[model samples]
Target: MRKWLVSVLLLCALPGLSGVCHGAGFKVSEQGAKAMGMGNAFAAQADDASALYFNPAGIAFLPGIQVSLGALGILVPQTDFHGTTPLSGTPPLDTGTAVVTEHSRRDIVIAPTLYASYALENLPLSFGLGVNATYPLSKSWDDSSVFRNQVQIASIKPINFQPTVAYRVDALNLGVAAGIDITYAMVSLQKSLYSPVIDPTAPAPPFGAYEVGSLGLNGTAIYMGYNLGLLWKPRRDLSFGLAYRSKITLDITGDANFLATTPTGMGAIGLSDSALFPYTRAHASSSASTSITLPDTLDLAIAWRPTDRITLEFDATRTGWSSFEKLEFHFDSPQFAAFNNQPDPRKWRDVWSYKFGAQYVVNPRLALRAGYSFDESPVPDQTVDPLLPDADRHSFSVGTGIGTTLGSVDLAYMWVHFVDRAVHNQEMTTLRGSNGVFKSDAYLLAANLNLKF
Candidate 1:
């Protein structure tokens, strides 16, 4: 029973804590500033070291060795939740008092990347390497937020390293690359507990109401996965690229520690902490374990040069979100013998995103870029909650760059607008008996320096 309780704690404590350099579902579309400026439409025009991530085959056509460094900073607007939700019995005020809980977030988050490429002096081959952030997501709600019973804080960070190679067959440019990812995640939530021996016969508190004994759970984990890419060029002015990133399943394992305030039943009966500490309760402390799968993605793109100074590109991506339809938690304690496999329904569906971008070169040292993308949400309206208030949206971007004797520096910015979502699910797991409207916006600034010898 003790082991079972621990498993239940871990199961409820884990969900949606992973990503890849993205699009919807905690993903970042651009790995470098140039790609950021072009709305990640560089798959076929992967000319720089960033090609290690976009399309490794393009590197086979380059000369000499190149190195690049870049960073992307996301400015997230507050995610507002105008509604009430289930609580784990953690109210800091009287039940009759009104509560005001608005939103959750941080002002800024950053993702960094590094890339290097070397073209063989006499061979039709090139080699490249890249290290970058594939996914970064962080959000924290007030301890008193309506959904406090579900989740108060969550942060997931993932990084990937890729080694790429390309071979040139006359007019054909063939490329392939593989990657390994390492991720770390943490989540904290509060749940109300009861002293059954003292109050088992008493009426249960209102559904989703907070009681005195609050259980806070937090955990951490690390895991790995691999990805590969392909690029092909049939003509001088047009090219095609494809990439497949595999799913990463995280076997998250850790320990859960419980922190309780004052017990309502204990205080009501005049008993104190010293007396309750000696009891062998299932939730006092225990080990945690669960499994989570990050989705996979397939990208198809084309880069075209219709004129000497103008270049155009487009990309279509399909994500395997159906894999997350149900999340299961495996427990290790006996307290939860009756319930072993606690399954949470995500019911997420496969989604698609499309991007288009254009670039113009005015001179040897200056260039300009612009692009746009349309993204679809995987979460259904019935399941949307403050923890993941996502909706269909669009992304617009613009950028400029300059070249010098040593290297070129590119700067780009993007604006993301999420369509307001009105959630009306009477059967929701958390926000029951309530309706909510979610509004959010975000911005990204990316910069990269490409140096060549």
Candidate 2:
């Protein structure tokens, strides 16, 4: 039981780890509709209640009480892959002229956000609260696809709560703020496992290539971090903003369940050698734990108001993904020595994204916005895999805001095009497919409602 459990856990742990980390592929940058419309470049022009997310210091410049509620809808079309993966064998075998083509299951995910802030009448102080999903992912491939052993289904849901306090230095036209981020995350993953029997005389590719079982992992974790922001207005037409978010380390505990599938012609071996195939036609569950350090982020931006009715902002963001250099997991039972303390090398690198956005106030009742961004991928080619086929992206967005006596509504639409990725690396060539060309794109629609009193 201990040996079988070790095999099951090691086979699926690394990919499972990737499922939860907020890599460039998993990070959801569109937290507000107004900001989304402006290419997420509103850090310096944080004038709305969404400022709690873009730049908490902007809250100090706001008057009265403000609240904003919104949701981002993501539509991911089928991701296309064409390539070949090695078959299970002592000396890995290839598909041999039988190239494979597969598509990932389409997914539609919705992430919502809420923010509220209050400014003191006499004191240059403001307090705000925000709730949002900064990182959410849902990816799936066909259950019986060639990549099944790598990953079939992966999903992560996380909620972040932030409470912020801002102070304004009216003398210097400067504002600074600090906040705490409390995040709770849940992760689930499923993947197939190949047989351990290495028979070369089998009629098919090989005995080791046969599907023997599947593994499922479910876990939850809670962690904390902090953020700081500064905003300054040197002149009426120009403003500068800076924001920083600290890294968070999550210690996750979960249950690992394994289910075995008896293959034809192997029934005799399973019956005779129960020690080798302990869980054949049976189920086993065990406890598993792991820790991961999410990356930190820094943002700098400049906002210029060329005219009373026009606002333009340019922002650059850097993510310290290098912190995710490796992954380590621990098994609960002491007998599982084979699968303990073995670290998997990720070697991810830090990346940057550049964005520019513009908004034009057409009238007191309407505003038009447009923006564009170039986002870089942190996954090196050596570490890229089917679980998260990350690539650089070009995003385009457009939106509008409508105001009424009661409140205002903001709507935005964005299209993201991933630079098709072609990989010929040795990351997981033997066990998990990694040589392929991946193409993917997504569409996002965001809407936010704002009210002030």
Which candidate number maximizes TM-score? 2
- Cα TM-score of candidate 2: 0.91
lDDT of 1 at 451: 98
Which candidate comes out best when scored by lDDT?
2
The ten-residue window of minimal lDDT in model 1 covers: 194-203
Question: Which portions of model 1 show Cα errors greater than 4 Å?
Answer: 1-12, 16-23, 87-101, 176-208, 212-218, 262-283, 333-340, 426-434
Report the C-alpha lDDT of model 1 over 1-453, residue by residue, as the tens digit: 223333333344445332221357667777888887988788878888888777666677678999999998988657876654443224432322233447775667788989998888888777878888766666676765655544566555556677767677755456655555555544444434333122212424443332334455555666676666677777778888887777877666655455444443333222342344543233345555667676888889998999878999999988888777766655454433433577766788789999898999999899999999888998888667665688888889999888998899999999988988887663322223236578888899999999998
Question: Whole-model lDDT for model 2 versus the true structure?
Answer: 0.80
lDDT of 2 by residue, 1-453 (tens): 333334433654446656566526578989999999999999998988899888899998988899999999999646898876643222233332346788999999899999999999989999999999987888888886777777888888989999999999999999999999998889889987654333212333342344456778999888899999999999999999999999988888888776655442132123222335634575556688888888999999999999999999999999999988887777775434456776777888999999999999999899999999999999888778778888999999999999987679999999999999998772332354456799999999999999998
Looking at candidate 2, the ten consecutive residues that score lowest on lDDT are: 264-273
Candidate 1 global Cα RMSD: 4.7
